[model samples]
Target: MTRPRIRWHIPVFLAPAVVIYTAVMIFPLVNTLRLALFSKIDQERVFVGLDNFRTLFFDPIWSEQFWNALGNNFWFFLIHMLVQNPIGIVLAAILSHPRLRFSALYRSAIFVPTILSFVIVGFAWKLILSPIWGIAPSMLDAVGLKSLFAPWLGKEEYALTTLALISVWQFVGIPMMLIYAALLSIPDEVIEAGEVDGITGMAAFWKIKLPLILPSIGIISILTFVGNFNAFDLIYASQGALAGPDYSTDILGTFMYRTFFGFQLQLGDPHMGSAIASAMFAIILVGVCLYLYGVQSRMRRYQL
Candidate 1:
């Protein structure tokens, strides 16, 4: 019997990608985790085990900001899951209609924001929503609804929610495109079968199409979870690193940034920042695991 080839060429082809990933992603992640376990004490980096985590969670000065940022992050995620995903699904469903005219145009227009720079979106929206010069107030005034307009971005109660909605507006197109592709992939036979059983229109969607697209939705949910936790650009672009209105819009990303780089008079603390980053990594890891093992498994079973 001849021995199987070693497949040296396959590894040769994969080596560059592996090396780049290790250098860019794996090494940085491992280093961040390592940094989280040490602290600069008396100008020396000392191994401190979980002391950084302890300070992050239990130290009075740090705990409040950490918990607040965490709560805001949850709210941010909730808004995306509740508002953005549903809107995207609805848009996808509408555009996926067989006879819908100008569907491509609509898709392009909606998806345009997804490709725009976060800085541009943040700045543009800030201007459009500006109380003194924004068109939002003018449009409201034109419609005789000016009374409803307020400085949404400047208020503590509204700042976080406002930023969240802006983010939703910018990214809702992503899930729409995903779901639209899923909807389009539904076999013609399936729809015909649904019709034969009187499951037409919305009924067909709820019964047949939706079940088949559950996996896509599950994937989108996980993506949203991971993306929202790692979010920084939009918030930073719109609200600044301070995430002001008394830090109402501060999420873990901004919190970690402030700690890592130091803003204004606050000195940078890399150790604490690494701890925060590690915490974020852990949260995202757990979320992905739960979705993979629990939600994804159930989705597969449902599909089967």
Candidate 2:
């Protein structure tokens, strides 16, 4: 049997997209990685191989900041995984219930935060949580829980965790919406079959609906991973570039920002910044690969 020759015009259809992708994404990524290989020596730019990376890992000053940021980043991701996702799942499951009254209003109210600017959310929360002249204390007083309130954003022990929870509160709508959509995509016939098998209500959800939505959960996990790792805006807007309380809320994004752009006492080092950027890229790449191979491979998608 003879196979037909591929069309020469095939490239024409892909040319514009390929060109744009290469110019906007591939080129910048390649250039950033290349920049990470070199260092500034005195007044001159010189190729330093992996010296910058070594310095970032071994030098006490740089390594301390890098590790601190990286550790905090992991914790940030962990909080989202533990608190944000579970709440979202519960909310989604509840919202997905058929014959629920005022579903649209509930959805719109819950999702309103997601549409607000991070700056607004961050600063607004900052003000609300402030120790002085904020309504938090008054509200607590009104409820007779005044003693339980503290300046969470000001304390080093609570700063990172507080910011993470704030982020979770602001973004929970995302996973809820995604999971809700996934739940809706499930065929009603499957649920009916579950009911016939005595798997109605929660049991039906656990056995039939949950398994089908595994792919969507996997996607949400990956999205959360990427978003949390790249998170900077909220922290920066509320806490400034230093990410105080003494950099407790420091993450790779803020760390890289400090390195890339001079802040207060430190002069900007583009090479080291590129190295940080490359490290972030490496971490995200590893995470995505593990999700794809480890998690996604084991998750079986069900047809509706």
User: TM-score: which candidate is best?
Assistant: 1
Q: Which digits, one per residue and each the tens of the lDDT, describe model 2 over residues 189-228? A: 8888888889998888888888899899999999999999
* Best lDDT among the predictions, by candidate number: 1
How does candidate 1 fare on TM-score? 0.96
* Reference-based lDDT, each prediction: 0.95, 0.94
> Candidate 1, which ten residues in sequence have the lowest lDDT sum?
295-304
163-274 in candidate 1: lDDT tens per residue? 9999999999999999999999887888998899898999998988888888899999999999999999999999999999899999999999999999999999999999
- Per-candidate Cα RMSD to the true structure, in Å, reads 1.7, 2.3
lDDT of 1 at 64: 95
